[model samples]
Target chain A: MKKSLEGRVAIVTGGGGGIGGEVSKWLAKEGAAVVVNDVGSDLSGGGFSSTPADGIVSEIIGSGGDAVANYDSVAQPDGAKRIVNAAMSMFGRLDIVCHAAGIVRDRMVFNMLEEEWDDVINVHLYGALNIVAEAVPIMKSQSYGRIILFSSVSALGNLGQCNYSAAKGGQIGIVQGLADELKVDNITINAVFPGADTRMTEGMSSTARAYIEQWGVSAESSDAQGIRSSVRNAPKVAYLCTEAAANITGQVIGVFGPPMTVYSQRVLMRKLYKSNAWQFDDLDFAIGSSLNRNIPESRLGGKYEQR
Target chain B: MGDRFRGKVALVTGEDHDLIKEISTLFASEGAAIVANCSHSEWVERMVSEINAVDGVAKVGHFDLTSMADAESLLNFTVDSFGKVDVFVSGIEIRDGGSVLDSVPEKWDEIIRPVMKNVFATTKYVSAHMRTQNSGQIVNIIRDKKIHHDISVTNSIITEAIIGFTRTTALDMEKYGVGCNAVISDHARNAALVSAYICSNLVTPGISSIFRVDEQEVSLYSVPAIERGIYSSDIFSVDELNYLVPKYLFDGEELS
Candidate 1:
């Protein structure tokens, strides 16, 4: 409604349903020519039909907005390039990119399979890379662009989600690296570690579900339909992708029900002793002493950490 | 350029020759009247003259950061001249010696007074002025790395103090629609003292090299070093700051 993004072109991967779909609709409503790239995969990253993408595109068009549909897997290089190309061909230029495509394979490291790791990694991390690799050149040429990558709280080392953590953590690292590198090019890159319910959470165990529910969301209500009907939390993931966030780069920000918080993952807390030779005993003593005196987590705890 | 900040006024304080010059010049070029202060009058005069030659409006104010009265005067003069204080950039860093046991009390006060206290006093006065107008942006430039020999204890304390001050001011001022944020940078090329420290004491056979002259050296510190140097222009360009400052001050709303 603000129209701050008028005349812009955006590509939202995993746009067939859930948060991605909402983000796509929001972008289109703001006057962006949106390309809803959905492969119609389930929570575990299996394929379905392209109907979901088609459905969202229809909804946008029916609401008197501009949108197109692309049924491509963000897991591959060619698929990623195709999504960017779709935006360029349909809308003529790309201004914003929201890489929200991901899958959840919850497993403890002891029982995690190689394919499980690869599947989540391929969808979230590589999918992000695929699109970014293709989009950066176009962004550089235009001298203006916004890239928003998705990280999750699980990246902070959640139980039974080693693979998910690895992928999400990698995404944060990529966001920071890209943000620092591309700021000079006028392309701002940032990561959002959102705490919202979606199709991804419905698959978690009941214990995990109960823990997340305390944060004010039900697992069942995160379905694609539930999100469309506004049954989820406030300040949806779409808010972070808007043009008003242009100045925030290389930051890991969290949003939950009207409370927006900026986190400091990269912090220099204590100055430990490091001499010409770092013996094991000396290193241990230095670390212990530093930890005892100053809690690194407590420095910026109130704003970021769970109360 | 456009008169985006035509009616706006800004103040920057520091002795880092390159940073002070670049920030003042950029603000002036964007139609914001600049009041730049340094310890030395010659540096201030030089910057003012250069800005004038480029058709930008700027005036030099010579003041030491150690004085609270001078800091208050800088804010008062800008508001008195331009009718409002819209932006503030703190670029002062005074590094002296201090460690846990060997640090002298005098040195501690000297180092903390200029870098951290100056910012606190300046923010106190400016936020008071901006609370009336209900809009302002404060960008505090901070060194991400601590340069201390035996002075590691005090260095960490001072660095953390600045960040705490910035965050506290941000939250307190948010109600009045004022925003304060810190820009963290690794050792900058223009910081002559930092450069000397890295070159002299840190250069050794086994010690991991801490500083790199080339832009690519940023990769060594973190994964994201796309280029070298820590100047405002290299880290965040004028256009980017223009976009960010307004966004932070207005909280994602469109600024007129």
Candidate 2:
């Protein structure tokens, strides 16, 4: 009997540690040849080391799995190209790309410097673009591919993660935006909002911690539940990259706990119409009377304290 | 009847499209001072003159869609001219067309940088100013009508990203009394009206939402919810999901 991914090849960006590292091991355990790409940047995305990627590759190889280490930064287009090339040269074909590389620059929107915003956006959002841009052609040629962008619950919005949110949020858009187009070639693109305890999240502020608590496991770990562990996120992510999950595309899945969740694609919730241009007073009255039902409570700003 | 924007100042930026022109004019007609920003100086100046001719305060500000410095200056130009900015309307047309597999990395940059990247810069600056005033509305008009099969996947991705960015900005700014929303429309008048309505006092500033405008109808995009879930103590493998998902999620119907 053969493993599920016996002949498949996968590129796991940021596979050096945490969820990405765990995911790399999982894919390898299933018999895929894995390219473990990591810059091994610190929590704030500064400094670099190759040890993370090398360590993960060593572990996989030692466990009777085929894997190679690639120290390429996904934030750059050329780096993404080299990362893909490394996979092809070592494994001959590329079939799966799990982009889990990320960094955080948490700060109040007002206090956030341009560099802070740029750094986070570059690593997370631009990095997603680079990797997918390189891998899509091979997948298209083969008529099969599975791409998973490791977005976060924070993409919806965190009190001090406007930059990170915007980047992760952009990734979700990429998944949805590319879904129909990719579906034509039997390729699938989806987002995974993983709630796990990782080094990237260890330094969260008190307000951010509280925000995560209120939002529950859908956003991050429900620490008390003890079920939404970091490694638990791997199965769902690995599953999405499999042939069994072929029909699922453009979906945003949250893997944090005992029960994995599929989020609804955004749609029209309520509408107000006017034959003529809507006046301020009239539009207000219409929304106030009808559209206000089930309006999402403000999650940030001063509303954060209301909890 | 048109005093909905009385005493307000608006910064309208985007293409030389009729939608951008109409939004500038409509806001001016509703008694708001207008800063019409576009790369085409002659076209925006013409619109500015048209608004000024109608006894509405209007000014022309230049912006290069891909330039962050230009974004900052555009906001500054609005404030310097009008004392303070009350509303910002961004209307950008998506560029390039091709499947992601066919396009190169530079193509992705070309498609994303001008629209989404610039929007991020403008939003960051405009919201910062809005936070101080404790009042403002932002309406991003992404012309999704032309986004079809031939359009690049990068284009679609950026479109979705802008929408997501809109939601995040709305959330981040709501506490400061700033409303951020995206408008998807091909119709000039409808998009203009929706932008005006969202900027109006009636819609609370803290509500970050997406609105689609077609003809006379304005519909709001809903926040995504959990469609369904199955509980378990441990994570399920592919085989287990193959069994349980069909039984529970699809009522025994196979996923096609």
* Winning candidate number (lDDT): 2
* TM-score of structure candidate 1: 0.52
Per-residue lDDT over A134-232 for candidate 1, one digit per residue giving the tens place of the 0 to 100 score: 888898899888888876655443445645655675566556545645777778777765545566765554433432343344455644433223212
Tell how far residue A169 is off in model 2, in angstroms: 2.6
lDDT of 2 by residue, A59-177 (tens): 99999999999998999989999999999999899999999998888876655677887888888888998899889989999999999999986765565777787788779877877
lDDT of 2 at B1: 36
**Candidate 1 RMSD to the real structure:** 23.9
lDDT of 2 by residue, B77-160 (tens): 889888898898988677655665566667766776667667777877888899999988888887764332344566666666
DockQ, structure candidate 2? 0.46
Task: Please estimate how well model 2 matches the true structure, expressed as its whole-model Cα lDDT.
Answer: 0.77
TM-scores, all models, native as reference: 0.52, 0.90
* Candidate 1 residue lDDT tens string, B135-181: 77766665543322222433444443444344445545556666554
**Candidate 1 ranges beyond 4 A from true positions:** A203-244, A274-276, A292-306, B1-256
Worst 10 residues of 2 chain B by lDDT: B144-153
